[model samples]
Target: MSEAYDLFVIGGGINGAGIARDAAGRGMKVLLVEKDDLASHTSSASTKLVHGGLRYLEQFEFRLVGESLREREVLLANAPHIIWPLRFVLPHVKGMRPKWMLQLGLAIYDRLGGKKTLPGSHRLDLRKAPHQAILQDSLKSGFEYADCWVEDSRLVVLTAMDAEARGATVLTRTECTALERHADSWTATLEGDGGKRTIEAACVVNAAGPWVDTVARTALGSGTPAHLRLVKGSHIIVPRAYPGDHAYIFQQPDKRIVFAIPYERDFTLIGTTDMLYEGDLDRVEISAEERAYLREAVTRYFRSGVTEEDIVSTYAGVRPLYEDKAASNSTVTRDYVFEVEAEGGAPILSVYGGKITTYRKLAEHALEKLAGHIDVPGEGWTADAPLPGGDMKDGDFAHFLWEASERHPWIPPEMLLRLARAYGTRLDIVVGEASSLEGLGEYLGGDLYEAELTYLATHEYARSAEDVLWRRSKLALHLPQDAILAVGAWFDARREAATP
Candidate 1:
């Protein structure tokens, strides 16, 4: 007999994971399946910010900005380890939007989200020490506001882990090949390492992100109306551009903004060009034009210009934005829209156009929509709930780190910080009973050890080196090439040993 579930969620991105976690918490038997790894596509490819779209105010997306701003507070409180405050310096230029407009926008942004832990926006003197040395001479002043930096893929994994902990089944590297809708349930064909099988679910949530239309067509047939405007956003990473913990928000002539954030402790992450994407969804990469565009975009502001020679790595992902008929790709609404189709048979809620900051709220809204067609039992509860390893005293990550340092003084400060930030209160699980560095199992490279990999595979559903290096953690950026190869070999050995 096929396994039965109250909810079946497709897509392992933030929205799908959040939906599964929310639904499972609401007393529903849930199963979430992802064709690839969690956050392997668009979710992992974000600019990695949790903020109210400060620029969206110009497009009058007040509701989205407000909701995102509010979510910043909720998410920060819930997951302080991965989601914390980041200050942004928005430099003002003579030809750009006037200072008064910027000031007014910041004012509205500050008030729209209501009372919050993060500080409100304020003016800055760019002629000061850090800005004078970092920015061009013509830039006399700017505005400073607060957002947050998130480990994008880690957030997805931790959310899925929480869902699993709450009794939901999370299957990674597993694809939902087909969906057969019945009046009271859905029979989905799933294919993965274990081969093919079918499972029945009372409802389905299509949070497939870039593949939303594909999944919808598979479930509702190919004639279904296409409502996705695929916009590709790309980012470039280079050796640290400037010296500071604060990030810069650069305004472009096209009225869009680009961010230059300090990444992985030793690199500057800049990016995100919005272009209409029409290529294969599975193989998205940054283009030559985008590389030059990003270089020029940052060069116009920084004292040190970014050139092609300085680029080290690049990534791109497509945002499956709801087709709002907006002329400019940059102006499409970041707010989520839902398409609930239940008239034919069982309910299938298709999600469209949402930002990472607002994913939790999107899930609540998704389940609320599903409730109209299915038996959604529990009330909204994710807002106050802490995700896996997120429970800290007063959600104070700093104090928690200090305490961890005391507990594991033998560990190096840098490695301790990385582990604590990645695992939070669950760092002990990664370390296991290792009382010293030697006990951490084989040293893979850098600060990585076999113990951490074991925890990831055992608890976090990590299957391959890419899953560990790129998504679950950014160790790939810091590890040597040989170490990277060794990680792959380790996974290969593990799989071989398990095989009959």
Candidate 2:
């Protein structure tokens, strides 16, 4: 007989992973399946901020901004290792929104989420030390506020990890090919390396992100109307643009804002252009126009103008925003909307449009919606639960790093810092009992080692070199071409050895 589950979740992105985690903790027999790796699409392709969407305040999305702001605090406390506070410098332009309006918005933003640990918004003197050398001479003053920088893909992985640890089965690179809803249950056909299989689920949560509408159609017939306005957002990476740990937010003449954030220690991450996306969802890439737009966006604010040659790499992803018939793609609401269909059969709740910062709350609310149709036990509990390796003494990353350094004195400072930041209290698990550099097994260029790769395969569901270099750690940015090839070879050999 096919295995029966209480709930079946489609998509391994943040939303699906979060729901699975919450449901499992509530004693539901849960399973989460993803067509690709976790966060391979929209979730991984964000501007990587856990902010309240300061720009959305202009559109009067006060509720969304406030909820997101509050969730930012919750996420930071739960996953301190992967999420941290980042200060942003928003310079006031000559013809842009007035300084008074900016100040008022900042003041509202500071209070909207209630009292928090992060420092409140404050005024900045652009004529001062760091800003004078980095920004243009024409920029006199601006505002500085607190947001957060998140390891986008890592956050998804850790959430899924937590879910798995709580007894939720997570199957990556597996696609849900068919969904047959009966009067009281769903028979889902999943295909992957293990081949096809059917499982019975009492309820379904469609958290397929960009494929939400498609999944809905698969379950509710082809005529189910689409609800998503695919908005393509792109970003460009370049060598360090400035010296400070702070990021810059530049205002465009079109009323949109662009960010240039310090990324991966040695690179500046600048992005995000919003355009109506109508092309392929599987392979999303930055258009030439988007690349130019981002370069020009930053050029107008910084002393050192960005050019085509300055761009080292670029990425783009589609935001499956809920269609509100907004005038512009940039102005569409980011708040999540749920479509529940339980009239004739078991309930299949489809999720639309939400940001990473609000994913936890989205899960709780999703379960609440399900509770009306089915029996759901337990109240919301993920708000205070720490994700894998996120627990530390008072959530102090620096103090944890210091203790790690004392224990692993032989490890290089740069390597230790990276490991500490990525793994938090789980650093020992990656390094094992290695006493010296050679104890980490074969070195894979940069600071990567075979031991870390083994840990990922054994515990983190990593199956390819791209999964390790790009999504898991971004080591591709630092490793040489030959070393990268070697990593691929290692995976190929491992797979071949397991083939028998």
Best by lDDT: 1
Model 1 stretches with alpha carbons more than 4 Å out:
223-226
On the 0 to 100 scale, the lDDT of residue 450 in model 1 is 97
Q: Mind giving the per-residue lDDT tens digits that candidate 2 earns over 196-293?
A: 99999999999998899889989989523547899999999999999989999999999999999999999999988999988989999999999999
| TM-score (C-alpha, index-matched) for candidate 1 | 0.99
Model 2 lDDT on a 0 to 1 scale: 0.93
Tens digit of per-residue lDDT, candidate 1, span 354-448: 99999999999998888789989969999999988899999999999999999999999999999999999999989989899999999899999
Q: lDDT (0-100) at residue 304 of candidate 2?
A: 92
Query: Candidate 2: lDDT of 94?
Result: 91
lDDT of each: 0.93, 0.93
Clashing pairs in 1: none
Candidate 1: residue 412 lDDT (0-100): 99
